[model samples]
Target: MKYRIGRVLISEGQLREKVKELGAQIREDYKGEKVIFVCVLKGAVIFFADLLREMGPEVDAQFDFLAISSYGASTVSSGIVKIQEDLSTDIHGENVIIVEDILDTGLSLSYISKLLRERAPKSLEICVLLDKEERRTQPVNVKYTGFKIPDEFVIGYGLDYAGHFRHLPSVHIAEPAE
Candidate 1:
C-alpha cells in the first residue's frame, strides 16, 4: 500500500525491539505482582497485540480495552476526550497498566488514568509506544516509553491519517498534498 509518505519514521523492527524492552522492564518491575493491561482501543490494537506477545514467559497479566476519542475522523486533537467505550470489568484491587499507541496532548491518557484511579486499582501506570512531549499541553507521565518523537503527524503501526496506513509496518508522516 502507498504510505502517502516517502519514508518510514519508525520501522517495524524498531517498534518490535522497543516492545521487547518494555516487556522485560515490566517483568522486572512488577516481579511478583499481577497486572491487568488496559489497552486503549482502535489505535492501540496493533501495539497491544505485539506488546503482549513480548511480555515474557512468566509475566502474568490480564487484558481489557477502553475505546476513547478526541480526534474522531480528524488527524489532530481538539484538546477534549470522550469515551466511546468504557471498561467492562472492575479494576478494583487489581494492578493496572494502561497501554496506548501514542501519548499526544496527554488529555485522553490523563483522563483515563483519573477514571481508573477512581476504581481504586492497587497500582496504576501508563506505557506508551510513542511520546510526543512537545505537543503536550498537559503534564503526563508514562512509565514505559518506546520512542520520543518529533511533533509530527505520524501514521502506521496503529497511528493513522483519517484511518489510513495503519497496516504499514512502520511510522511515516504523509506529505501534505498540494
Candidate 2:
C-alpha cells in the first residue's frame, strides 16, 4: 500500500528554526540545572535528536526514551494507551522534559505525564513539535509547541502513516495515490 504526499504542511527550514527556538528557551529556563529529556520513542526520535542538538553544549542535559502506543497501524489513535517500553532511570528529584512528536488526542501523552509525575520528578513539562487541537479529548499542558497544525493526516518529519514517511525532511498532508 503506497501513499502519496500532498501539500507541504511544514517546511524543513521551519522545523529547524522552531527546534532552535525551543532549545534556546529550554536552555534558558533550566540554566545551571541538570535536566533530563524523556523522549517519547519512535515518532519523537527525530525531533528529540534535533532538539538536543539545538540546545548546544552549554546546557546540562541527559536523555532517556519511553515508548507508548495509542496508534498502531491506524491513522487515528485506538484510544488505548499502552506502555511499550519504560525508562531505565529513576527520575526522582530530576528536572524532566517530555519531548513528543505531536499532541493530537493527548491520550498517550496524558498517560505518559501522569506516569512520570508519579515518580516524583523535581519538575515535569511537555515539549511537542506539533499540536492538532481539533481532536483533543484530553488536555495536555504543552510548554513548548513548534506548530499548531490543522486536523490532517500529516506524514514526514517524524510523523508517519503506518510505518512509512517518517524519514522525510518536511511534513506533508498524506494522501492515497491513485
Give the residue spans of candidate 1 off by over 4 A.
1-3
Give model 1's TM-score versus the native structure.
0.94
Global fold similarity of model 2 (TM-score): 0.97
Q: List the residue pairs that clash in candidate 2.
A: none
Worst 10 residues of 1 by lDDT: 1-10
Which regions of candidate 2 deviate over 4 angstroms?
none
lDDT of 1: 0.86
Report the C-alpha lDDT of model 2 over 63-176, residue by residue, as the tens digit.
999988888988889999999899999899999999999999999999999999999999999999999988899989999999999999899988888888999999999988
TM-score of every candidate relative to the true structure: 0.94, 0.97
Clashes found in each candidate (C-alpha, N, C closer than 3 A): 0, 0
Q: Taking the tens digit of each residue's C-alpha lDDT, what string does model 1 give over 38-115?
A: 999899899999888876657777899999889977768877889999999899999899999999888899899999
Which has the greatest lDDT?
2
